[model samples]
Target: MSKLRVGVIGCGSIAQFRHLPEYAASQEVELVAVCDIVEDRVKEIANKYGAKAFTDYKELISSGEVDAVSVCTPNYLHAPISIEALNNGLHVLCEKPMATSQEEADAMIQAAQKNDKKLMIAHNQRFVRSHQLARQLIESGEIGKIYSFRTAFGHPGPEGWSVDGKDSWFFVKEKAYIGAMGDLGVHKTDLLRYLLGEEIVEVGAFIETTAKEFADVDDTAVCALKTESGIIGTLAASWSYTAKEDNSTIIYGEKAIIRLEDNPAYSLVVQYTNGETVNYELGKIQSNDEGGQQTTHVINHFVSAVVENKEPLITGEEGMKSLAVILAAIKSNETKTIAKVFE
Candidate 1:
C-alpha cells in the first residue's frame, strides 16, 4: 500500500503539538492537507508541513487526495467533520469526548458504519505503555479482584495553552459545552474504563466553575462511578489546580494497590499486601504531558488501522463510551443523583 495521504482539521495547540508533528514524523503517512477557520493559521501549518491549506474542512476532505483525515477541530465540530470525512470515503481520527451528546456520537458512529470507514477517537491514554501494562496486570489477577480506584487529570486553565486564550471557544458554553469534564474529565473516565475493562454503569458527580473568570464551564469536576462488573471508583478532572498534576490513576485490589502516572516515565507502582513495594517504570514511547504521548500513539494507531484494515484501540464506539461517562457526570451534577450509564 502507498503512504496514507492525511488531512488535518484545526491548526490549534493539539494539532500543532500532538497530531501534526506525529503525522509529519510517521514514515507511512503523508501530510497532504491542513484546514482551520483562521486562514493564517492554516497557511502557516500547511507551509510547515508542505501541504495544501484550507479554511473549510469540507474542501480539504473532498480534495480526493486524502486517504485519512484527523478531525482536530473544536469539540463541537468533531461529529460533523468526522461524519463528512467518513461519508466521503476517508478514514477519520477525531479528538476526544467523541461528541457533546449521545445523539451526535450516535450519528458519527452510524456514519462510519454506513460508509464502511474507520472512525477513531483520539483517546491517547489507551496508547500509554503503562496503561497497557496496568490493564494486563489487573486482568491477570496480579492485583487480585479489583474493588476500587481513583483517577484525575488536572492542570492550570487553557488560556496560555489554547490558541484563543481566554477568548478560546473552550470557555464559551455554546461552543465547547461542558468545560473541564469534556476537556480533561473524559480522558480519566476513558482511562479508568480501559484499566478496569468494564463499562461504567452509574455515575454521581459534582461539576463546578470555580476559578476562571466568567468561565461557563466547570473548572473542577468529580464523579463517582460504578463499573459494569461491580467495581466502584472516583474520577476527578480540574483545570483549576494550582500545581500541575499529570493525569494519575490508582487502583486497589485484594493483593495490592497500583499507581500509574503518564509522564516522566509512564510507570506502574505496586504496593503489595505482603508489605513489599515495587515500581516498574515503563519507558516513554513519545512526547507527552498530562495529555501524554497518547496523541502520537493514537495518530499512529489511526494510520495503522487505516492501512491494515484493523480496529483501533479507541474506536468511535469506545469514544462514545467515554463521552457517556462525561455526560453522566454532567447529568449527575444537574440532578444531584447517580445517573445510570449503559442502562
Candidate 2:
C-alpha cells in the first residue's frame, strides 16, 4: 500500500510533541508538507522532517503534496482550516474542542460529508488503556446501572505546556474561544461519552478566571452534567492546580464503584457492594509534567483509518456531540441556569 502523504498545519507544542513525531514514526505515512504562520517554526519542522514548508495554510492545502492533514492550530482556526482542508479533498485530523460554537462544528461536519473525506477529532483521552478498560467493564454489566460520577482534568496551567509559554494563544480569548473548559473540559466530555456510551443532555456551569493573571479566559470551571439516561455528574476543569494535577474520575454504580487514575499503583480500581474488589494495573494517564509518557494511539488510529479507508472512532459527528456539551456549559455559565445540549 502506498503511504498516505501527510501535512501538519501547526508548529506548536501539540504538533511538535504529538502529531509530527507520530507521523514520522508511522510507516504508512509520508511527511510531505508542513505549514505555520510562523516562518521559523514551520521551516524548522519542515527541515527536520524533510518536507516542504509554507507560511500560508491555503498554499499548503492547494499544493497537492499531501493527501491528509492535521489541523493543530488555535481553537478559533480549527473549524475554518479543517473545513477548508476537507473542501480541498484532504482528510483532516483536527485537534479538539472541535469548534467554538455548534454552528462551526456543524459546518465542519457538513464540509466533510460534502467532500466525502474523513474528519477525526484528536480526543486522546479515549485512547488511554485505563479508559478503555473502564468502558469495557461498564458495557459488560460489571458495573450495574451507573448512578453518578465526578471527573476532573486539571494542571498547573498551559504556560508550562504551550510552546509560547505564558504568552500562548491558549490564554487569548479571541484565539482560544474558551479557556479551561475548551482546553480541558471538552476532553472529559468526550471521554465520558465514550466510556458511558451516553450523551450529555444538559449542563449547569460555574466558570471563572481566578488564577491566571494575564488570561482573559476562565482559568477554572466546574460543570454539572446530566446524561441522556439521567445519570448526573460533576465535571471540573482547571488551570489552578499548582501543587499537583488531578485527572481522576469516579463512577458510582449499583453494583460497584469504579475509580480511574485515583491511585498511583493502580490506574483503575473497582470496589463492589458485594464485598468483592478488582484492581487493574493499567499504566498511568499522560500528564503535562516533564518526561511524562503518553501513547500516540490517536495518531495511529487516524492514520489507520485513512490508509484502510475506514471511519475513525471519533468522527466529525462524534466530535460535534462532545463539543455541544461544552458549548452548553458555556451557555449555562453565561445565563446562570441549566442549558440544554444540542438544542
Candidate 3:
C-alpha cells in the first residue's frame, strides 16, 4: 500500500502540535514537505518529520511528491492556501473558521469543485467521543425537542500556545481576522451545529478585549443564536480565562437535558425531567498534539477518509457551514443587529 504524501503549510503551533505529529503517526500518510513563511521553523519541522522544507507555500503545493496538503496557517491564509492546493490537484485539510469571510469560503468551495479534490476542515470537535455520543442521542430523539442550548470554549491565552506568545499572529487582526470568536468560538459553533444537525440562521453578538495588552483583537465574545428550527442558544468563547476549560455544551430538551464537558474526564451527563440523571464516560475525546491531543484524532480522521476514498467526518461544506455562524456573529457584533447567517 502506498502512503499518502502530505505537505503541511505553516509550521506554527497548530501544525507542529496537531497536524505534523498526527501525519507522522498515520499509517497511511508520509510527510512529504513542510512550508512556512518563517524559514527556520519550516526547516525545523521538515527535519523533524523527515520531509523537504520550503519557505514558499507555492513550492510545496507545486511539489509533485505531495498528494495532499494541510493548510494550518493563520485564519486569513486558510482559504487562499487551501484553494491553491486543491487547484494543484492535491487534497486539502484546512484549519477553521474556514476563512476570514464568507466570500473567501465560497471561493475555496468553488476551487475544490473545479479541481474535483476533497477539502476538509479541522473542526476536530466533531470527532470527539462525547460530542459524537451527544449527537447520537439527539438524533435518536432520546432527548426530545431541544429548546435552548449553550456552548463555550475557553483557554488562558494563545501566548502560551504559540512560540512567540504576544508577538504571535494571534494578537494581530490582520493575521487572525477575529480573536476568540474565530479561534475558539468557531469550534463550539461547529460542534453545536453538528450535534444538533441544525443551521444557525441568525446571530446577535457582543465582543470584548478583556486582557492581553498588545492584543487588539477580541479576547472574549458572547453570541446568541437562533437555529432554523427555532431552537435558541448561546455560544461563548474566551482567551481571557484564568483557568482553561475545553469545549462544553448544554442542550435543554422537553424530556431531558444533556451536558457535555471536556475536562475532569470527557463525558456526557443527562438530567431528566423526572429528576433522574445518567452519566456517560466517553473515555478520551479526540484532540490535537496540544494540551488534549484532539488534533491527532481529527488528523487521523482526514487521513482515514483519504485512504478509504470516503468523505471526512467534517467535510469542507460542513466547515463552511460552521464558518457561516462565526461570520454572522462577527457581523452581528459590528452592526449591533442580529445578522442572518444565510444572508
lDDT of each: 0.85, 0.93, 0.85
Overall local distance difference test of candidate 3: 0.85
Least accurate 10 contiguous residues by lDDT in model 2 = 287-296
* 10 residues in a row with least lDDT, candidate 1: 285-294
Clashing pairs in 3: 286-294, 287-293, 287-294, 287-295, 288-293, 288-294, 288-295, 288-296
- Candidate 2's residue-wise lDDT over 1-343, tens digit each? 7889999999999998889988998889999999999999888989999999999999999998899999999999999999899999999999999899989999999999999999999999898899999999999998999999999999999898889999999999999999999999999999999989999999999999999989999999999999999999999999998988899999999999999999889999999999988899987787777544465688999999988889999999999999999999999999999999988
How many backbone collisions does model 1 have?
A: 1
What is the total number of backbone clashes in candidate 2? 0
> TM-score of every model?
0.95, 0.98, 0.96
RMSD of each: 2.0, 1.0, 1.7
State how far residue 144 of model 3 sits from its true place (Å). 0.7
Candidate 1 lDDT by residue in tens digits, 134-177: 89999999999998999988888787688888988889888788
Model 1 residue 18 CA deviation (Å) reads: 0.9
Off by over 4 Å in 3: 262-266, 284-290
lDDT of 3 by residue, 1-343 (tens): 8999999988888887788888988889988899988887777777878999999989889879899999988888898889888989999999888899878988998998898788899887877778888889899999999999998888788888887888989999999999999998988888888888988899999998988778989999999999999999898899877664556789999989988873465378989999998888777554322464554477887888878888887787888889888888888888999999978
The segments of candidate 1 whose C-alpha lies over 4 angstroms from its true place after superposition are: 262-266, 284-295
lDDT of 1: 0.85
